[model samples]
Target: MRILGLVFAGTSTPDRSQMADFLGDTLGLPRVEVGGVEADLFELPDGSTFAVASPGGMGAPRSVGFLVDDLDAAAADLREAGVEVGPIGENERERYLHFRAPDRELYELTERKAGIA
Candidate 1:
């Protein structure tokens, strides 16, 4: 399982609206829509995604996701290493799985589609 890059980082705040203003207006990161919701997605020039959500929007307050060359192999390797993995999540561009790390934080491994970076 070869790790590629840090593809995503997200944090859930009780005041997402305020955070959104800072991210979009102050930082100048372009906002993208997620499932019809505005002001959550921000893409860096390098293609890494930073997201801010309401506390209830996700299961965890913070998440970090890495890019993996092979999702299935990584999942198998994680299981063999005794990691607790959650279900795989898929979108049009990528597939990802969440897992609990030794620190008890939830991290993600994503396999992007062929045409997507």
Candidate 2:
């Protein structure tokens, strides 16, 4: 089966409010709620959709996954912003780093390999 997109980043309502600020104020993504869950409904220019969910310990949401053009550069930028970035994991198609926000939800950043297309 083919996957079109993903919804990630599960947190409590209060924490989700803070995350919404970071995503909206810091990252500049529009905030939206779906099915009663508040989210930073991220829409990339390439038409990719990613979501952050505020669940009251009910839904089974996965960790947030972000696609970056450069893994090292992105990690460095996040580090400069004082974000805690984890070690990167590499595969044939991409490299990824995991990081935790103040709300403690994990987020992943991925860099697809060169010439993937």
Candidate 3:
């Protein structure tokens, strides 16, 4: 399993511009706001993206996003392995399913959009 990115979600009013500035100045990350909400795409110095969004926007807090080659196959494998997986949802341009691990941590398996790598 590979982790593509981490999503930090909160209910507070998000400030995209401020976030962009902070990320660029402090963390030296490049940011791009893809939508009207507080959802922003952050390009880490290592070339990976860490997306931040309002709680009501992208996902819940502490949500772990996994990058999978095939969503259906991954989901099937998880189910066959006796994991309880949730239904898949359509995101901005991808399909993803959420599940809880034995420790109660939320995990997400996703088929990202083409060219995201």
Check candidate 3 and list the clashing pairs: none
- Mind giving the per-residue lDDT tens digits that candidate 3 earns over 54-95? 544554554666777788888988898889999987646567
Ordered from best to worst TM-score, the candidate numbers read: 1, 3, 2
Report the C-alpha lDDT of model 1 over 47-74, residue by residue, as the tens digit: 9888898885656899899999999999
Residue 51 of candidate 3: its Cα lDDT? 63
**TM-score of each prediction:** 0.91, 0.48, 0.65
lDDT of 1 at 60: 85
Displacement of the residue 94 alpha carbon in candidate 1, Å = 1.4
Q: What value does the lDDT take at residue 69 in candidate 3?
A: 74
How far residue 76's Cα lies from its native spot in candidate 3, in Å, is 0.9
Give one digit per residue, the lDDT tens place, for model 2 in 1-117. 122243233444546667767777898766544333245565545544445556743233456666676778889888998998899876564576788879887777766668752
Task: Show where candidate 3 strays beyond 4 Å.
Answer: 1-21, 35-38, 45-47, 56-59
Pairs in steric clash, model 2: none
Cα deviation of 84, candidate 3, in Å: 2.4
How far residue 14's Cα lies from its native spot in candidate 1, in Å, is 1.4
